[model samples]
Target: MRGLSLKMLKKITNPVLLRSDLLMVVLNRDSHWILVVLDLKAKQICIFDSIKNPAHKDVVFKLVEVLYQESESFQSFAISEWPVIYVELLPRQSSSSDCGVFVMKYMERLLDISDGEWSWRQYLNWQVEMNVFRAQIAYDIIKFGEQFAKEPAKDTKFCNI
Candidate 1:
């Protein structure tokens, strides 16, 4: 995928993305959450949704095209040629209201696993009660806040709203 052509490298605006191995984006379509993961090393774009939707793949392709056009670093890559995979066998949300929680958990699990150890089938096998997951998320947030509050202010600056 490297040293393809000079013409393809003209529009790169973000160097950070070029260096990243994985890019994960969460999308909301009609209030339903969807996860799009761009695996640069694997040369594939994977879409994970609680409820399968084929139309979302097109949206991700369009987004990649826009990124290629706007960013010089992405111009060398051809997203149209790369395979787009729709992960079908994932742990689904039992209720529509849990889509956000599902997406968050998906991201958390993905990040927790090592690159070589990723397996969609084994990802979320454990039973996840939405209510329990929500409480855990809340607890994590509160714990983070408490730890952050304990740290002394550094280079403090105040601005009027």
Candidate 2:
């Protein structure tokens, strides 16, 4: 860990959660979990949930795929949603004919809407500290708008575009 200090995050119970043109990662512990099929080049940590159905995959990102079960097929469900895993993330905008996708195991519950009364681990610790305090106030407003952009008089005449 480059200089460890008791870091956290680990224990991925089976992976794969595509759609959004594939790229949605959040497995920590000095991370590494890339999976891109049908090439869109490849980088990572891309999450664009356009207000819904991962916003219908920005209009069908190639017929999506995600539906796994079979590990004892979850003992026919309802065991208090035990070690929960029902699998679903398929066929976009979900369920016209219904498949209610799920792939939970040790979930960190999602689907939050301003956490009505907070309790899913205190709404996941205020959604991870309000997304690291809104990404440090959007990097201090883009470093104070590039150190206060307003320069053009040192003798003018500076064109190069």
lDDT of each: 0.73, 0.26
**TM-score, every prediction:** 0.76, 0.22
Q: Candidate 2, which segments miss by more than 4 Å at Cα?
A: 1-47, 50-55, 58-126, 146-161
Question: Which candidate number has the best TM-score?
Answer: 1
Q: Residues 32-88, candidate 1, lDDT per residue (tens digit)?
A: 889988888898998988877788887788767766665556666666567889988
For each of the candidates, give the backbone clash count.
5, 4
Which tens-of-lDDT digit does each residue in 7-41 have in candidate 2?
11111112321222222232211122111122122
Candidate 2 least-lDDT 10 residues: 98-107
| Quality of model 1 by C-alpha lDDT | 0.73
